[model samples]
Target: MWITYFFSSLLRFISVVFYGEITTDFKPCIEFFYAETIPQGISGDYQALCQHYENQYHFATLYDRNRRIPLFSAYILSPGDGPRPKNTNWMIEPRLVSDKVNTGMEYQKHPDQNVKNSQAVNEDYKHSGYTRGHLAPSGHQQTEEDKEATFTLTNIAPQMEKFNNGPWNNLEDEMAERFKVCTSKMYVITGVMPYEKDEPKINNRVTVPEYFWTAYCCPTFTAGPDQNYFPTYAAVGRNDPNSKDDIVKKNTQDGHDVKEMSLEDLEKILQNRLKMPEMSLFKNKCKE
Candidate 1:
């Protein structure tokens, strides 16, 4: 899983993330991206992962190794055909912390010594008052393996319980419902917006996102024009209950809120916060 990207840096070094095996090309999980084209606008300390499990490519995750959180996860919309996995058991992305990973992901119970230093281990979230929220939610997957593949820590970020269980959960559910009526393949990219600087971390490990976001692109919809959210739609939810309501108003009883808007607006907000003026969610051809 050697991932080399075109993004440049001060060091002028090519961005690369080595996984279990050497990959000669970038198409390890290209099917996850819209038009087989990765989204742009993110630069700095990031690694792209072709998330694999049980000898299968499940999705793609652009991870921030420095922040120890996924920048975003891209996947095809596949609603689960069975009930959710009971008693979730989280796992670790081996390549983030090491160059050779025979297994794509492994249980975090007894992680390697340097594992805690390179990535977030199970211990990081313990007693941290933050939930291990999924960027690629398990419910969005159809098979048992795909759902279980999402348990890897590489696809997780620290999320407040109220925000995770409230508005965030609702947004995921809504996406599932929308997928049911889609005529074309739905490409979903779910991610987070980190604070401008000095962001909070869980147990001094994983960065807690300021906002959780998700957007989807389905060019053709059987649901018709009025109900069609294709070829793009987006939403962002507040992770901090005490934060101001300028972006997402506190609409729930315990003060959780989600704001649904056009995909462009979400990109605008990310650009401002990330200072990466071109912050975007999908490729140029993802829309009409």
Candidate 2:
């Protein structure tokens, strides 16, 4: 037992140094952030995830176990070399349910009582009229395992059908294209904004978000076509058609379109809408 434990610890350390996984810490997965920095001013009932899958760390997510959804997912933008994974074998993080469980994510099998009670499961989303939207979308991933890793329920939120398939997905495609031309690494953080009060839920479990938001900070980059902005950019899209046309406007398809803005402006909007006195998504807004 002791020998087995030693090797496991050794291997985990190697992963942290070489692959940039943060498995054991109060702030999990700092390696996923640029300059080892995390977003500030977020509080109230959340868990940070290293996003381990198939013995690898794919990204980072700040999960709300109470709401059974991710507040945000942060990852280094890859060139997205191949097609999206066809498999829908979504997964779950066992550590979220029990700290004693020491393993990477596992396939989302039948939801036992503890698993069902602790987090959202496949049944919670079955016929729930909402798609299992990914906070770190698979399309942004370069490898098959990383793409598959994004399917974990902990990194997912309940998204509207048209919104996910339409504007939101389109935004992802555009970001991918923009990232392809960049000469340096780009760190992207995608997240959702829940209603300030009496948030809605699906299957009485997973909380649905009112709006989806994403931002990227590229400290240094070679300019692509139609390029003027640098360092950081952001956008927010409406998940509800009935929402007011302020941050994002209505489109012809009876849905809201994505609106891009400066990273600083986006933080102010999040601070106001989420009711936090202050909010910052990146360290120095990625100035350094």
The local distance difference test score of each candidate is 0.80, 0.81
Q: Over the stretch 2-103, how does candidate 2's per-residue lDDT look in tens digits?
A: 999999999866654432332334355676787787777765556777888878789998778888898889998885677878866878888888878778
Give TM-scores for every candidate, taking all chains together and pairing residue i with residue i: 0.88, 0.88
Best by lDDT: 2
Candidate 1 lDDT, 185-234, residue by residue in tens: 89999999888677998777688888888889887777664374667899
Question: Candidate 2 — which pairs collide?
Answer: none
Local lDDT at 40 for model 1: 65
Can you tell me which runs of candidate 2 are displaced by over 4 Å? 1-28
Which stretches of model 1 miss by more than 4 angstroms? 1-26, 225-228
- Per-residue lDDT, model 1, residue 97, is 73
